[model samples]
Target chain A: MDILDLAFMQRALLAALLVGVTAPAIGTYLVQRRQALMGDGLGHVALTGVGLGFLLNESPVWMATAVCIAGAVVMELIRWYGRTRGDIALAMLFYGGMAGGVMLMNLSDSGSSANLSSYLFGSIATVSEEDLVAICILAAFVILTTVGLRRQLFAICQDEEFARVTGLPVRMLNLLVAVTAAVTVTVAMRVVGLLLVSALMVIPVAASQQIARSFKATFALAVGIGVTVTVSGTATSYYADVPSGATIVLFAIGLFVVLTALATPLAKRRAGRTAAAEECTLEAPGERTAADDVRV
Target chain B: MEQPVIALRGGVASLGGRPVLRGVDLAVRPGEVVALLGANGSGKSTAVRSIVGQVPLTGGELELFGTPQRRFRDWARVGYVPQRTTAAGGVPATVREVVSSGRLARTRFGMMRRADKEAVIRALELVGMADRLGDPVDALSGGQHQRVLIARALAGEPELLIMDEPMAGVDLASQEVLAEALRAQVARGATVLLVLHELGPLEPLIDRAVVLRDGCVVHDGPPPEAVGQHALPGHDHVHPHAGPAAEPIRTGLLT
Candidate 1:
């Protein structure tokens, strides 16, 4: 089938394109901050959110989104519970959330009501018009916030305590990050399953960082890779009868490997050239002061 | 004598129900470089953080610029630089942007305006990193990163600059560069309060020394007079400034 032939395929493409652009954009900072695991952990927390949605007879997507945001707040509260063991707090949260979700799922007798498999593993073929709309709106929100606070967000991710010392309101910025991660997981859950959304968020950016020369370049490359994985994975699943989630993950990993291989040689060549140039320039530091001031 | 730019009166700070700073009274005036000397857990950093509003005082009053203020929001006039550069230096930001963060307190809801931008540039220039404004902070050497952090702290154009162990683990070159910059800040009429373990290397850089032992001010005088003494042995003297001292010590001396 042509990539956009079916109406559902068109919706799927739109959703993926939207999710692709925003997830990696946010993920770039997450990766830089070394909080890449936050995405995965938050994604798992979304499972209980889905379960809560199923239980309430509300639109499961809306309910799930709400629950996911609540989980984000819960994650923030865990900070007060313990220090230096955020992972332990995260694990406790993850287990408790999952258990609550299971109980909710069983209580509602909705084990099979909402096509739990589709939410857990994801299916592009099942993209509904409503899902497409939700993805677009949430994606827009994510993009706007990320761009508006890009500078501060980047600063906080790089060094929170330092940012605080500079009077950047570090704790508030951290809460914003956690909230954004939750929102990204909620929107992305439609394209890739909740369990797999973080892979999409982190993999492309991880690959991009291996090759890109600067942070901005890495961010751009990650977005490109995200779009590529989503589009290709959708098409491959349509024609090859493979699992969409697995196909998306495999495509991301494949791209990561290829990019790493390509980047290694290029990075080496650039390193050698720059080293020679640096030696020449430093030898006459006085002469190159004009350009050195602005060179990245 | 001039009034203290930062004044903490009868202040007490505690972590986990134990006091770190007990009835600690201190004052820092403009152009004075006060070294907060302490053994590993002496609340030297805690007092500095309290001055800047990073840590809440469990009791007592904190005043910035001679006003009777109770909270950190009131002390934005006082700038702070913590010990660790690696914390903020990891951001892929340029040296300029990192310095620009100093204007956060003055910004409207922390937004950077045109004047804010200029101040950031000026601050970086002050720290001698204006030449490397576009370079990623992480690309710099540790000392360079430390300078950038100082530049950031200076961006606020603060009357008081509080630093917690700015020289810890720093190379000799960085130490000298930072010491010079710190002196320059004081020369510009900014009060400087720094927390340190030993006063040997930093003896000449400071005007006065305020030493804490067991969460109380055990010594408060000129660094020249305080140099020969070490508050205690086996103390890292580099612990967080806000929390109670992590050291087990004789607590009744200052009480």
Candidate 2:
């Protein structure tokens, strides 16, 4: 089989592109909201949703999507009920969901025969045309919602009470964010598997934040980083004969560390330059016009 | 003279199974900047949270713009600013994008109109933040962040703005700017209520003070009378100066 055959590489490339775009689009918000952990949680939730489908002899993707949506809604409801302590609620739901799944899998005799380990760690070789189509659809949905609600999500993530006070339907926006996460988790389940999808959600953003000057740049850079990691990890796995998901995560971690190191020196120099400029200039700090900040 | 924009009677609020606010009764009319004063854990934040529906009323009746709390449509007229600015520190959004969020209650899901842009721009200008409208919030100073938050609240065109510790971490210069902007907000016929630990800087900026202790309203009146009520013992009313003549503190905006 020619490694460069147009169709074979095209399918993999399409999968990588869809995963690259959707994960970071949703991951940017998740990382900012301190719910990066939710990505890990929902990944597990999708696993259970997938497991349930396997036990019942149903289409795993359909079952997983349905379960992921249900899990997202439950997470939202739990958060609403426990408003003041959001982290506690998230932990409870994530752990409880996983426990329920483990028990269900243990009790079902059929679950043992399904080779569910691959689902936990993921197996990209199983990427079917149907799964690819689903990823494409999910990618569109994530992009559209993110772009459409960009301002609202930005404000709410920064300060929900502030956003709520301004009458932004904080709860509905929260649900939208969670649903976006669920969709991303479902799409990612095929590539990174349940346990590791969160790395895809968090590492790229962390790396981008180290170097990007503004929110727009950070998100764009994060998405770019995501795609780069996926492509490099895929290439490395083929060459080295290692697990692709683990390779991808290791590559992302390397990117984050290198970026952080480079960013520190650059940020220090910029600060020094700005501080010197401030002494010579009379313009009040924070008085720069919106245009100036935007340009940065 | 007009109906109170917010009214709570015997309202109670609990957090993490602990009662933070108990039997609290308070009300505010439009254009009034009411200061909430209390020692730590006196339920000041809880009382404010109840008004915005962030904290549910465990008991008693709560109303907004004369409608029952449950019937109060979000963003219809109420606005809130929590103590923590809560902006995502790393997202790549500009100040304009954040201010435009104030219209979330109004815009639904779609492109913003010229009117929305105008409102956002006006909000930025009001807070002395118009120049930084394009700046990313993460790069801002603490004072600038606070002003951006105020800009966010103003973008909603809210009839009532509820701010929690709005001045806590703000620098003196930014405080003056925020105070001037708040005065303008009151002048524009909006109701303002805020929680503050110290009344020195904010004394002159507000119309009245609602003092809270142990989750209940100890006094609600002009700054003078409220100060008097604090001295009538059975409650701990220790001011920074116990001296008999610490000139009647003007509440709201330090300078």
* Model 2 TM-score relative to the real fold: 0.81
Reference-based lDDT, each prediction: 0.74, 0.76
User: How would you encode candidate 1's per-residue C-alpha lDDT over A1-296 as one tens digit per residue?
Assistant: 56667788898888877778888988988877777778788877787877877777766677777777888887877764666797788898887776776667777766673567678778767877877777778788889877778767866776565566555667888788888888888788877887888898899998987766456667788899999998888788878988777888899999999998998899789679869875542465456443233222
What's the DockQ of model 1? 0.18
Q: In model 1, what are the clashing residue pairs, if there are any?
A: A158-B91, A159-B87, A159-B88, B45-B241, B46-B241
Candidate 1: tens digits of C-alpha lDDT, residues B45-127: 77877666667788998787777755445445667787653322212455666676667777776578899999888788776
Cα misplacement distance, residue A273 of candidate 2 (Å): 2.7
Report the lDDT of model 2 for residue A154: 76
TM-score of chain A for the candidates in order shown: 0.88, 0.86
Task: Output the TM-score of candidate 1.
Answer: 0.83
- For model 1, the superposed segments whose C-alpha errors exceed 4 Å read A84-89, A106-114, A213-215, A277-296, B1-3, B15-18, B67-69, B74-76, B85-93, B108-115, B197-205, B226-255
RMSD each, Å: 7.5, 7.3
| lDDT by residue for model 2 (A263-291), tens | 98999998898798757657878787643
